[model samples]
Target chain A: MSGADTVVWMVQNAGSEAGSREVRVCGPALGPDLRLARLDEERLGPYSPGIYAEALSALIAGERGEERERRTIVLLPHTYQVAEFAPLLAVQLGAAYIPSICGAGREAEGGGLRFRRAILQAKLQAEVRPRARTVVATLQSGAFGSDEPPASPTRVVDVCLPADMERSHERQILGREAAGAGGVDLAGAERIVTAGRGVGGADQVSVAADLASALGAELGASRPVVDNGWLPREHQVGSSGHTVAPSLYVALGVSGSIQHLMGMSGSRVIVAINKDPEAPIFSVAHYGIVGDLHEVAPALTRLLNERAARRRS
Target chain B: MLPRRQTGEWGLRIGVCIKQVPDTDAHPRIADSGRHVDDRDVNWVISSCDLCALEEALLLIEAAEQAGGGRPELVAFSLGPARVEEALRKALALGADRAVHLLDDGFQGGDALADGRALAAALRREECDLVIAGAQSDDLGQAATPAVLAQVLGRPYAWLVMAVDLEREHRSVRVLRELEAGMNEVLRLELPAVLAVQAGINKPRFASLRGTLQARRKPLERMDSSSLGLDPESVGKAGAGIETTAIRLPPTGGGGLLIDNASPEAAAAELIAHLEREALL
Candidate 1:
């Protein structure tokens, strides 16, 4: 592998928190494996599509001089795939893409073909692999997994970007913007306590909070909770909210929907607490408790606190 | 409509992502293997809300062109398989100057995240000032793309964009943001960013008599994953990391609770007892 003449590492950098200043051109390898400096080094992010993109740009170019020069970074995108749109899009932009058919069956993991609907409703599953210099990877949602993402110390480079105001999309932005809002950003939390409809209602969310506080974790809610206006939209998890990859995610009273699960399935250790025995959340949960959350949440909180106290003593 | 009145002589290249969804009302037909959806049986329509986003792109191009400015090329990108050509052509016919296709053998299976990755990757080769796409896909309603694509493009972006007004030379944008609680937030975003427009933000127009005719002449581009620099692992099931293992649709909530009532007092007591028995009290 040392025969690698030129080695380049591309990192996704973004806005103020990471501060945009550098430029990474695609070239070679990513050097050494990343060794995280701080266990608390988390990549908490926003959910708004606009903000997410704005922030991501900053992230990719935010690093220092050498880091930016030697890195070939690309931003992680969040968009939908239309069955027929991908091929046509590939040609229009003069870019190549691999498409895939899903929602039908599981991947055999080692195969290249499947025999499903023959044709015309009988479709085969496929993927789009790009054949260009820059690779746009639709990374699997849960690929990042639960962990404190490692951060490497790097040099910062500043580049003056010119104005690109040729479009009619002129909209003056105000308020906090999508970059600096603070709420339940469980996608990057080291530890998270998330509530679902099983939590009963907004009132019971506080109990999840109590548990979160005991664990020094963030509080997150599923879409239902947000829809009812019990929790802020920022706190909603799943496909709509931040796609988190927390180290430890404790699900309280939430019956995991595919959407909700898609967002948090990346968590390292998932402990699901739901009263429903048949709830889908159990399929991927590392640990599960089938009991009323009202009883379980408080009890679990009390137990964790006492354990921490005993350890301190 | 008047590009000359706005930013004189400079132009903007715009991209619109359109999806062809089976009519929302289409029912599922299960075969021996699995459920099959006959898109033909269902009316094929432009993503309901994406029309607004596309119209916005069209207006911007017209405005920029009128300004005697840079060349504004509106390219429509369709992501599905060959079948998506219909939607792609529709976008072109509607007003897009050209079109591109990003479908391939392996792109057929996966979830929203996978789709987003592929689209963003395809966009990397092209240089455009603005990438305008709908807020979400109708079937999955996984409003994840615009943001995720922005992330992939490594550009600043915004979503629920109610309105976008660009001011050239100053490099500023005036935007109306739709808040979750039915409130609207206004913002000014710098250029070279992504924005997911809210549905109904603009009045989407039908193809005009002349415009529809001109669309057929618009050039359409087509490509596959083998052309883009992706992981080469067929993006569909072969490359997928997660396996469904098993999937079961949820059962419809069986009718609900039944309460018996005779006398008013008796009825009240019956409900109370039922609540206690259900541990709902």
Candidate 2:
């Protein structure tokens, strides 16, 4: 295809405005002539991968076009959901499903397109080529700049959840619970300050918390912090925890384990503060400070507070 | 097919799908071909999240036993080369009653979908009450296998499952799925459902010496492509829907600028100035 033959953006209401924004940010990269397929969360109710797959299959099959040599791009919101849906969608549309895509662009050498994603736990980035006619991918949060140009007026198609979907009774939504006090909504936060094991005692976590408060950032934790009971499960960020793509991610005393990096590598700007100079977090950090987080965190908070005072004056 | 309730000696027959993956902490060396990483020198272990899934199954078995119901039979399943038997054995050692190893030369390089199809085929033979797998494998990290297997097997599925509660009396399971921003959705799935469990849902127990000895003697069945009656065209490289064109290291980020100052206060101020210059503060 010369350009993208057709782009289908699967927009899911993630119960947050930022979720919608993240979906829209991929529009520019998808090129014009975008078709917005809004997956109404209210209608779909809770997520069941099987039901969603059937619905998506029906939607794609309903499209009237030549079966072969058609290029389609499907954009998904959450990576976890993407994992659940991509394979089924790819099978339905005869596409290649790529996960954790950070960038996509027309191939300079080849006539088709290419995608860029991190592999080896974010230690390496791979440029991928989809041999299939259709390509399905989930863009990492914060991968694309949010400065999207006014999109071309496009039709939003509402995918109705099939009546038979409820008849199965195989999948049910019991209820939802709050993540708890230490639970930080890292995905929605523009700024995040994360603490790791190197932060020492649980009491020292307050120092990082103070810095986060000064910067108007959410407080996040590596696996060890949560494992050690210094923070709640929801505060944890890594393969096991929430994947956050904030504007600014400040790592305090974190050694930047590969699993932790996998969750936060999409941040626009990363700042690392660690006593050890060889910490891997510095590799991806825009700025680094080699100092004890106990002292550095408090000092940074103080300076930020002073800046705020200066602004007030 | 509607899942039938259990009314026999066992409370629930649970199948846990696990994988042997290169340790995530190991230094990854891109192969000479650059299409994939060289695993020859890397030590392989059970994918981290898979351990959590195994632990979850073990916990469920314990819960069933405590509820006055007979102990549940937990089966660990894996598909890979001969080396993968090690991982299945580890699962057995960790408390699985039995294991099914799907091994064949043709099984190599099967993408997530192909692997799922093969696994689903194997699972049909086991006829378990519930199937659990890691949210995603550490190697591909696509997190698609269990969901695809559920679809192929015609079963309901949930992903990123944080907690699973079995209501044996109701012939159903209630699972808490972790979503974005610390939000969790509680799902009640009928029996015979598949769940891709998240890591840290439970702390995986190390195998006791006694458990390890028992695992060696436990039944570990081996099946291949022919035993499952799978089509040759639908597995391995031929079955892979996505073809990897190239693999190369990502370009390094901006040179990490270390802020040097005489005092902590000075360092903090310098960092703020840098953030200001970058319009980040």
Candidate 3:
């Protein structure tokens, strides 16, 4: 493992009242090394990419001379906001920027630190090494669960933003709104069967839907299936749609984009059926069948129905 | 007839960056060096998301014209080897007023930062009122160049944009940005900002025969490193911040069982027995 001698956690709080609560909550887990930065809505308004890039660039640059030579790795959660401004921050600091990173290790050749990132819509993986001393990377959510707090408390320093730091005059935040009306709530589902683009046309979606019905599973749809109008927007399962972690997840004809996999990879048991053996979905599946869904799905549905009939008699 | 907009003054100019990528349908074979995908004999096309960005630019210009605003000029920009001109010509056929190509041997093998620097230099020369591009490329899928370009150009940037509405005076634009789990945030950016459009924003229109014919006469300009006043060392492989040590297939899951295809009945029977043994059926 690549170990860091020093670690710093920057916490963002809106108002003075909530500021104390954050310190109380984050102090224990993050230990003594917590830096609080105030971004009250009254002063900065809703989250602005301009303010974030400026604030973070300053904080990261403020490291002492002795600490700077060891190399700095700035890790951000791969959320929508971080995805927007992290690259800009990297440019401002002249550091390497690698987004959607899933893993890290030391390379065998030079023993240099390397990061793993998904490419080609998660169909392939690339091991990237930073050419610069400072690196900025966004870790894909769920890729790394919460870590245990440190045994020893470290030094802490608070970094404040300039009182006259410019606001985002070029961009203004209007408001946030839900993408669609409350669609099918799949959060509580025990089992889910998600149909993907390889499921073919709207008429062919029944192959997966029937299997879902026979297995007593909720019907889910990948982004492309929903985008093609084969399924409604509510049934969509992905980062931009719904994040579900059911007990069982059976992906039918799904190629498994990164966003889609992030949402459902936490399921207890995963089964993938697709004609393409190289499909990324198989990488995460507990059981996989390489075959046409049209043939495999109907056969499974028939077997389930026969078993149900026998149980009833 | 569409209201004509002059090139130099009193008209808004929107620059769209387009990238040609290997078709997603083609399986990428790792090259011998193991640093990147093998580009030989691969079919290339304009990335789907970038096509949406171009379509959005054309729509905004048309809307401005219909609202009695000045006819907006749409200029398409692309940076790549000689084959990139094909993508630029296609952009012209799709309704762009002009096209600019940033081509040079020095620009090859660049990371996002290097590529963005070269693009920002060319865009500065054009004095574009606005810039737009796809949120991510279909090949590398890095999704960083646009943001880097925006930072280098010192402009406000918005990613995963779903909707765009320009103000009547053409001073600012209102856009909706896509967030996780079907959430959206509405934002307004002043003119001269950059936007990274997401897929599914709008359906791109196909080129008409007349449009294709007229595109042949459209002026296509080529630019090199010296012309853009950029140091060659700071704009390509020499300036890259990250190095790809290797590209390989992802490791499979924890000893996952792989069942080969057989007769549908036989496969289904095997699956049922396995599920039953695990008490999952």
Q: Which residue pairs come into collision in candidate 2?
A: none
Q: How would you encode candidate 1's per-residue C-alpha lDDT over B17-57 as one tens digit per residue?
A: 77777664344333333333434457777786577789988
Give the TM-score of each candidate.
Answer: 0.46, 0.84, 0.90
Query: Compared with the true structure, what per-residue lDDT tens digits does model 3 show for residues A1-313?
Result: 2334323343343433312332333233312343344445565456777777777778777662447645666655676777888899889889888888877555555457788898877777899988987777776755653343423224433435557686657888789998766746777888999999999999999999899999999999997888678988778888777889998899999998888888898888888999999898998898899999899999999999999999999
Off by over 4 Å in 3: A1-45, A64-68, A108-110, A145-160, B1-10
lDDT for each residue of candidate 1 in A1-313, tens digit (9 for 90 to 100): 3212212222232332121111121111122322111101134222233322233233333432345333222322122322112222222222223222221111355322121111111111222222332222222233232233433424332322214412233333356334214654565678888888778787778989998898788888886677566787677666546667777787887777545766777676677767665565765676656666776677667766775798899
Please give the distance, in angstroms, between residue B141's alpha carbon in candidate 1 and its true position after superposition.
1.6
Select the stronger candidate by TM-score from 1 and 3: 3
DockQ of each: 0.08, 0.49, 0.71
lDDT of 3 by residue, B1-281 (tens): 12334843345789999999998877888899998888898898999889999999999988878777467888899999999999999999999998989999999878999999999998888878789899889877778999998899999899999899987465888999997777899999998889999887888999999999999998788998999999999877888899898999888765778887578778888888878876788
Worst lDDT 10-window in candidate 2 chain A: A10-19
The better-scoring model by TM-score among 2 and 3 is: 3
The Cα error of candidate 3 at residue B179, in Å, is 1.3
lDDT scores for all predictions? Answer: 0.53, 0.77, 0.81
DockQ of prediction 2: 0.49
Over the stretch B1-281, how does candidate 2's per-residue lDDT look in tens digits? 22333434755688999998898766678888888888789999999889999999999888888887688888889999989999998898899988999998898878777788899988888888799999877767777788777778777888888899989778888999876545788989888889999876887899999998998998888888999899977887777767666777665545878886658888998888888987987
Worst 10-residue lDDT window, candidate 3 chain A: A22-31
**Residue pair clashes in candidate 3:** none
